[model samples]
Target: MLTEERYAAILKLLEEKKAVSVLELTELLNSSESTIRRDLTALHRMGKLTKVHGGATSINGVYQMTEDKTSVRHNLHVEEKNRIAQCAASLVHKNDFVFLDAGTTTERMIDYLHEQDAVYVTNGIVHARKLAEKGLEAYILSGKIKAVTEAIVGTEAVHSLQRYHFSIGFFGTNGMRAGDGFSTPDIEEARVKTEAIQRCNKRYVLADPSKYNQLYSVIFADLSQAAVITTALPDKQLRSHTTVIETDLGKEQTSS
Candidate 1:
């Protein structure tokens, strides 16, 4: 395997096992002992893992704040995102108006929503296109499109979102906790999310377990304001403020 591929493999293993010995990594990666050592050294230097005498351990299991492109994110947690999306979409009934926040998980919501008789307002450029292709009524928010996530943000989008109240507002966040509820990396996007949350009657944040307890660049709304639809329930600390609805994704059915 290539060096980058080996590195990613090792990291994925570490994520599952938390640590791995040299023999295990070498066999798992199908590489020589010397090669595994070299890869470990390189990863250690990059601060992605901690290289010990004969193996490595993960620094922390929390998701980092780095912003990945939307395309890359779609396949990262497909099953879990779909589960969250499915549950979120179920909340919509005929003639209900919904607000969709721009993120990979939120985008997955459109896949199941194709059959729902709901009117949609969204800030995701790609989401609007997908909704339209599915023959749903979708309104794309008006504003500047963010390069990384393709989310419509800035003053115009926030102001436009405030104009309409929604029956349900579904959002995906970079991170969430009790204090910094649903947050993102950009203040402009945060503003839009904050505005939408206020305009909606029932607000829900679609965050898989991977997003819980992690903090990001800005806080949009507190946990007290919204419900959480996720595969795993949050800890007692987070549950004190927000309502968490847990769903069994049957994720093992389709994870490649």
Candidate 2:
């Protein structure tokens, strides 16, 4: 087949399946794996598709540059988020210093958290209040608040994270892709997350299955930098690169 014909065939298959592995494409097109990979790379450069390890996914599968309001996001994937949150909360021990990033899933974690002796610090305004309501030791960072996510972000927030190292940190991300890693839309918020991750001894990103295979503008931390806590991980290839805690298993299943 001609190169253009192969490209058309690849894109049509992607449109049908949303994602296609190089092996699948090679067999479908009666071409070599090397040829399919070259096509994928060219398509990726042209912004026609997202080239993931061993496969290619449609561009539509990726997230947008803008984030939804907190109220809107809070209603999505409630059950899955709760499962991830419970698993995250279980990891917190007494007297540990925890940094909780602002997001609906991370906020859900507060309900399951019973570590009253653990000191909590957050860039999330609502998280701070919720922690206080639970009578947990909590501190809210001082910084300019972003209205959409209601997270405190700025130089001061990053500076605040520098003062003390956290025992474990739980973060939220708008997107999680193998290449881009953990990402959020806003750069300042990403900065805060990046700083917090650097200062923590252990880090985890809490996300539902929908967050996978997505990419955003700003990358906060690399995929290998943090373990992911989720109800399910749709991408099997991702498991090979990082630690993933799948909470929906009868017991927590850790895969690296």
Candidate 3:
């Protein structure tokens, strides 16, 4: 491929997948490894992408480097979150093993869960109590509680997740973008979220429409790792990256 064409392909991959491997790029572009490396370097120099150890990442990954208190975040997008959560909760069915990530939107999901036979494993303190009230079997991982988010995170929480794999995991992110993937500000929580996603059979991220274009410090997974359950999806690039269930418009816009 021509150098300009290779550059465009690389950026498109970063925009849709959030990250790209050098080895994969060479094969995709029908170019040499060195040529792909040079293209990535040029893009990085232009402030178009960030060069990582073995790949490139989009520059629009994170906008906020810190997480807000759960109570504060819970009130920020109340209606949008509810719609997103409801759409996500509908994915669960009886006898499913679910992983509930620690976030306000995931917490909102507690109100919409219709699966009485689903067993849950979570890292959120609030999530456990709410689960128990409904007489569902819920396990809370052991770890130091984060005061701001009221979620457990640390070595223990990360280790605990290794024991069980979920049928599907529901998550919320501090930052969202076609190029940013699912990200959060706290590295500790990011670690636990990372482990959970790895152990789960499938992943789903619950986010409000406003989350798009936002960035956080740590990316836990690529946009392709999960089907996004959100109120609206306005980014065309994002629409092509992963499956999106739009609650506001009552339409499912799916792509491969």
Candidate that scores best on TM-score: 2
Q: What is the C-alpha lDDT of each candidate?
A: 0.80, 0.85, 0.83
Q: Compared with the true structure, what per-residue lDDT tens digits does model 3 show for residues 1-256?
A: 7888888889888776665667879888888888989998899889787665456656675467876688778876576788888888888998899999988999989998878889999999999999999888899999999999999999999998988989999988876777668788899999999999888888988876546666788899898888888766655677788898888678788976
CA displacement after TM-score superposition, residue 3 of candidate 2 (Å): 32
Residues 1-256, candidate 1, lDDT per residue (tens digit)? 9999999999998787555677888888889999999998899889787665457766554544567788887766566688789988877888889998999998888887854578999999989999999989889989998989989999999889878999889998888766667778888988999999999999889987556566777889988888888776525566777877777733212111
C-alpha lDDT (0 to 100) for residue 142 of candidate 2:
91
Better TM-score candidate (2, 3)? 2
Better of 1 and 3 by TM-score: 3
What total of clashing residue pairs does each candidate reach?
0, 0, 3
How many residue pairs of model 1 clash at the backbone? 0
Give the Å error, residue 252, model 1: 22
Q: Give the better candidate number (2 or 3) by lDDT.
A: 2
TM-score of 1: 0.73
Please provide TM-scores, in order, for all candidate models, with all chains considered together: 0.73, 0.76, 0.75
